[model samples]
Target: MEAFRNAVRMVINRSSDDQQLDCVLMASVQKQLTEVADAVTSVWPLAALSDLERRECAKTSAVRRFPTRSIVYDDDRNSNEANAYFVLEGRCTCMQRLRVRKMTTNGRNRFALIRDHDGHGQSHNLDTQKNVQTVYVKMSDLRPGSVFGLGERRSGRVVIATADVKCLLVPLSFLSKHNGSNIWGRTVCSLDGTNPTIEQSFRKFVVENRWEEYKKSLANDLFRKRRP
Candidate 1:
């Protein structure tokens, strides 16, 4: 119980604040930790870690809270090589940015939205407006234990809080240093067994990288949808 409270304090990031990590809240904090662990069990990748490793990960991590619609990561500048996030509370959304040109067709006033896949491609002499609009498309809705932030699978992508969110910032360095098979390795956790049913396949879908056929998968969730 004390270990987990220290973990929370480490992430709370109020080094200057005097709010004590007192014994007074022991009962409440212990109950919360138990609930958080239950959520992590369903988050398979994190689940691969032994219970002790998972707790250690939190104790060494940084925790941050983001209010609704705040940006958690911006593909261009937000992540370092090992930077990743594990949702401990609430949810988030991954969005990808696209730039499109409005093309004037057949010298008439009709306009069409044309994708600029190459960024330099022309529309067969059609007049392309200099003012290209930037749009963000929803890639996925992330819940607890959902790990993200190692740059974008899609260029110009970002993760944003769909609701107020609290995430434990993990380096994901454990992938190369600790328990479980390499993410790319075909070896399976004996624990996953013959059949897998986690978060009704939402987590599996993300882990399998199947959402809209995205070739990349997030590591896993860390806890339940809500936390104290």
Candidate 2:
């Protein structure tokens, strides 16, 4: 890391001193950029690209860090800023208000409906009754090798760091349907869907967000607001 800092300092000096590129300074900058490319390769499909290709990707990407409790992404507030994140360190919680319906279900093995007196029957064959109560729930935890935000945009989802976090921020264009590989093969899930790696990284998010605790309190919370 110090080498990267020194390389920048050297550039500053050369710009002011009108000095030429020396062998040592040139090597330092090249090495740092190469290291950055290695980190970019951790995301899928990019690894399959040639060295020059991924390095170009690295050039456009950035490393971002957030402190615990900081908002990493909020769809409502950050609509203009969109990208997929590759986790490098720590954890985050993803939250959203989702409508969840509690339903009472009853279905027997009988496929035929009861007929009327003149052999006339009901138009519908299924005999299921409906009783559902709707409520909202939200939240998650993210970890290393996990990715998010691609398929989650405009979803009212908010990602907050649960611990100090570090991530590789890659542009959405790399895997988007309009701009990327799915243009032909249509095999990969773009930002419109969660990546497999994101599934692994945030597997424990539901538990971390405490769904039961929220469910227990939701009714009381709504009553309090509605009564007034």
Candidate 3:
């Protein structure tokens, strides 16, 4: 309960003084509150709020609430077009579903495993590692996942909307070009079961690469072919 209060205070402190309380802020608060609820419910299983907890959390975070609805979008890969829906039923601390509407098309899905590490001499300090939160996202949607690579075997995949996809997941350092362009550092790739950070090098990398452009090109190509 103390931790929950502190988390809420931290959130409130960070908000702008004049800013009106809004759904986004409420969502942030609810997420933190849910984290606390999970920790407490674990030890006292009988007190678990179960599905009601999730629904309440979602409602508290919104001005208006309704039953979870499927989000349909065209899939761009097959050129026949496809759609995917997200069903919000239950919630675990791991994946919290938020409702949103969008379109989709068919194409290949890609994944990248990114691992961040401390600088050469900074490993001894606890503060250096305390703030670390490692998460893997689908290259296309930036959705969190545990695995990377193709096929249903891999944990994360949202059908490909087009071809010409280049998925590269690296540390923020690499993405920000902090280590200089064309230089790749040793990082672990979860593609293989073994976690190894091998020193690899590259050139011509940008702070933000052409990922968006690549996705657009693939979508356009798929759309063109499907046109009669």
Candidate-wise lDDT, in order: 0.57, 0.60, 0.31
Candidate 1 lDDT by residue in tens digits, 64-180: 789998988786676344656778888898766545443454542222244434366653332455755655556668888566653324346678998999876656565446644
- 10 residues in a row with least lDDT, candidate 2: 108-117
lDDT of 3 by residue, 150-213 (tens): 1112222222222222221222321223223322121122332332112110011111224665
Error of 2 at 210 (Å): 14
Give one digit per residue, the lDDT tens place, for model 2 in 1-228.
Answer: 999999999989878665454566778777766666777877566677677777767887777789999988876677776567788889987765332222323521111112212245434322342322222234446788677755543345677888999888777765553345453133224433442232232333334335655676787799899995
Overlapping backbone residue pairs in candidate 1 total 5
Q: How many steric clashes between backbone atoms does each model show?
A: 5, 3, 20
TM-score of each: 0.50, 0.50, 0.15
Off by over 4 Å in 2: 1-35, 97-137, 177-228
Instruction: Sort every candidate by TM-score, greatest first.
Output: 1, 2, 3
Candidate 3 TM-score, true structure as reference: 0.15
Candidate 1 lDDT for residue 184: 19
